[model samples]
Target chain A: MIFLKFLLYVWMVLVLLGAFFYAPLAKGLGEYTRVMYFHVPMAWITTLTFLIGAIYSILYLRKKDIRYDYYSETANQLGLLFALLATITGSIWAKMSWGAFWNWDPRETSIFILLLIYAAYFALRSAIEQQDRKAALSAVYDILAFVTVPFFIFIVPRIYSSLHPDPLINTQGKVTMNGKMQLVFFNSLLAFTMVYFWMLKNKLEVIKLKMKLKQLES
Target chain B: MIKAYYIFRKDLLQEFKTRFAMNAILLFAVVTLSAVSFAIGTFTARQEVLSALLWIILFFSSMSGLSHIFVKEEEAKTADTLKLVASASAIFLGKFLFNIVLLFLLEIIVVPLFIALMNFNVQNYLLLFFTLFIGSFGLAGGGTMVAAIISKSGAKGALFTVLSFPILLPVLVSGISATKIASQEQGWMTAYSELQTLFAFSVVIITASILLFDFVWNE
Candidate 1:
C-alpha cells in the first residue's frame, strides 16, 4: 500500500508536469485549454463516484448490510466534493472564455442540477434519525438521483446549443485532440481516477476505524 | 391491480371529503399566478418567458401539496395499516394515481387562469395539453416516490420541496420548452422531442419507484 501511494504521488506529479509543459496550446483557447486536463477529469470523477455510489446503494438495499451503506455514503460525499470542484473550476474557466462567470450553459445548468440532487441527498439523510432508515432512504435516493443523470448529462445538453467546447469525443465520434495532447489528457484522466480510488480507500478505512472505535467505547 | 384500485379509491374518497391536498394546491397556484400576473401587468413578456413562468408556477404548486399524499398517511399512523392491507407496489401506484388526478384537476383550473391573466397565447393547444399531461405524469411519478421517502423523515415539510426539485427538473425543463413551442404556434413535430423526453422520464421514474418502493415501504 505504501508503495502504491508513493507511485501515485509520482504519477500525479508527472501528470501535472505534462499538463503544464507537454500539452501544446490549442487553436483558440491558448493557455486556458490546459484547464481541460484538470477540469474534465474532475467532472469525469464526479460521474464515476456517483455511479459507484448508486451501485453500492443497490448492494446495500439488496443485502441490508451496513458496510455497503457506509461505502455508498462515502462515495456520494466524495462525488459531491468532486462535483463542487468541477463546478468551481468550470466557472473560473467560463469567466476566462465566455466573459461571464455563468452563462447558464447547458453544461452549467446540468451540473447545478446535479449539485442540488446530491445536496438533497444529504438533507434527506440529516432529517432521518434512525440509522437503518437513514441508510435505506438515502440508498434509495442515491439510486433515484443517478437515474436522472443520463438525461441531465446527455439529453439536456443535446437540447440546448452549448457554449462549452465540443466534448473530447464529439458527436461525429472523433477524438479532436492531437496525438500528444491526447496522451497527456488520457494520462491526466488516469491519474485523477487513481486519485479518486485512493481517496475512496482511505475514506473507507477511516470509517471502518471510526466504527470500531465506537464499538469499543460502547 | 384491483388492490391498487381500492387504494386509489380510498385516497380519492378521503381527498374528496377533506379536500386537503386539493385546496393547498389550488390556492397556491392561484396566489402565485395572481402575484405573477400583477407583478408583470402589461409587461408583455416574451412567449419563452411566459411559457417558463407557467411551468414555474405549476412546479411550485405541485410541490406545495403533492407530499401530503404520503405525509398524511404517516401523520395519521395509517401507513403501517395500509402496508398490511396492500402490497408496497400497490400502495405506490394508488398514491401515484391520486397525485396524477390531483395534478390534472389543478391544471384544469390553473391553466385557464394562467392564460387569461398572463395573456399567454397557444396556437397549438393540443401540444400544450400533451406536454402538461405527460409532464404531470413525470411530476407525480417522481414526486410520489420522493414523498414516500421524505414522509418517513423527521423534517417532512421543508424536505419535500428540497428533495423533489432536482428530481422534477427534467420534467420542468422539457415542459417549459414544449410549452414555448406550442405557444409559438409550432406543430407537433417541433415539440416531439420534448414530449418523448417527458414520456420517458415518467416511465423510468415510475418503474424505478415500483421496484424500489418495497424497501422504503417495508422499512
Candidate 2:
C-alpha cells in the first residue's frame, strides 16, 4: 500500500509538471498547440478505457462473470467522462483556431456519435431490470459498437479532409516533435495512464461493494 | 428457410387480422404529409425544399411505425412464448422484413403525395426510386434492431428516436445526400459509391445485431 501511494504521488507530480510546461512548450509551435497536451492525453486515456471495457465485456460474455460485468461498467462510466473532457477541450481548441464551436467535420461528428452510442448503451442497461440480461445485452452491444469505432474514428475521417491535426505520436515514434516536446508528451502519456488505472481500480471496488450490498438485501 | 418464411407469414397475417399496425402507420403517414404540404404552400413552388421536406416526413413517419414494433407483444405477454419456439434469427428476420414492408407502403403513399402537393418533378424516377429504396432499407434494418432493444426497455415512441438517432447518423447523412443527388438526376456512378456504402452499412449492422440478438433477447 505504501509503495502504491508513492507511485501515485510520483505520477501526479509528473502530470502537474507536464501541464505546467505545456503552454511554454506549445508556444514554440503555436498558441493553439497548448490544447494538445491535455486533449490528446485525455483522448488516448478515454480510448484506452473503452478498449478495456470492450475486453471486459467479451470476458463477461464468455464466463458469465458478474465481477467482469462490474469492471466493464466501471470502465464505460469513466470512459464516457474522459471522452466528454476530450470533446470539450477539442472544441475549445477548435474555437480558438477556427472561430467555430461546432462544425460538421468528420472527426467531431464521429466522436459525438461515439458518445451518443455509449449513452444509449447505459440507457439500454437501465431499461432492463434483470441483472444477468443487462450484463449480456450490454456486453453484446459493447463488442459490436467497439467494432465500429475504428471505422468511425479512422476510416471515415481520413476519407474526408478536416481541420483536425494528425497525431504527433505515430507507430514509428514521435512524428516531428523536438526532443523536449517528445519528453514532455511521453511523460504526460505515462502519467495519464497511471491515473486511469488508479481510478479504474477504485471504481471497480466500489461497484463490487454495491453489488454485494444489493445481494444481501435480497 | 421455410420456417423463417412461416414466421414472416404469421406476422403479416396477425397484423392484417387486427389491421392496427398498418392502419396506424398509413393514417399517420397521410396526415403528417398533408399537414406538411399545407404548411409548405405548394410542392412545385420549391423543388429543392420539397425534396428535403419529403425525407423529413419519411424519417418521422418511420419513427411511429418503429415505436410500437414490440409493444403489443409485451402487453399480450406473447414475447416469451415467441422466444421459446422461434429462433432469435427468425424473429429478427421476420420483424425486419415486416418493417420494410410497412415502410415501403408508407413511402408509396407519402412519396406521391409529396410530389403532388409540393409540385416537384422527379427528373430521374428510377434513380429517385433506387435511392429511396436503399435509404429505407438502411433505416428499417437499423431501426428494427434498436426497436427490439428499446422494446425491452418498456419506453416506446420518442424514447425510440432518442436511442436510435445517434446510431442512425450515417444513414441519415447518406440518405439525404443520395436523395439530393438523385433528385438532380445525377449519373449512377456519381452516387454509386454512396449507395454502396449505405448497402454495406445495412448488411454489417443487420449481421451484427442478429448475432447479438440472442444475447439481448435471452436476457
- The superposed Cα distance between candidate 1 and the true structure at residue B86, in angstroms, equals 0.9
List of clashing residue pairs for candidate 1: none
lDDT of 1 by residue, B128-215 (tens): 9999999999999999999999988889889888998998899999999999999997578878888888999998999999999999
Instruction: For candidate 2, write residues A84-185 as lDDT tens digits.
Output: 999999999888888898887887988898899899888878777788877886787787677667656765565456778775544456466667777777
**What are the DockQ scores of the candidates, in order?**
0.83, 0.43
Off by over 4 Å in 1: none
lDDT per residue as tens, model 1, A1-218: 89999999999999999999998988776687788999999999999999999999999999998889999999999999999999988998998889998989999999999999999999898888899999999999989989988999988988878988877556888888899899999999999999999999999999899889998999
CAPRI-style quality class for the chain A–B interface of candidate 2 = acceptable
Runs with alpha carbons beyond 4 Å of true place in candidate 2: A19-29, A167-174, A211-218, B42-52, B119-124
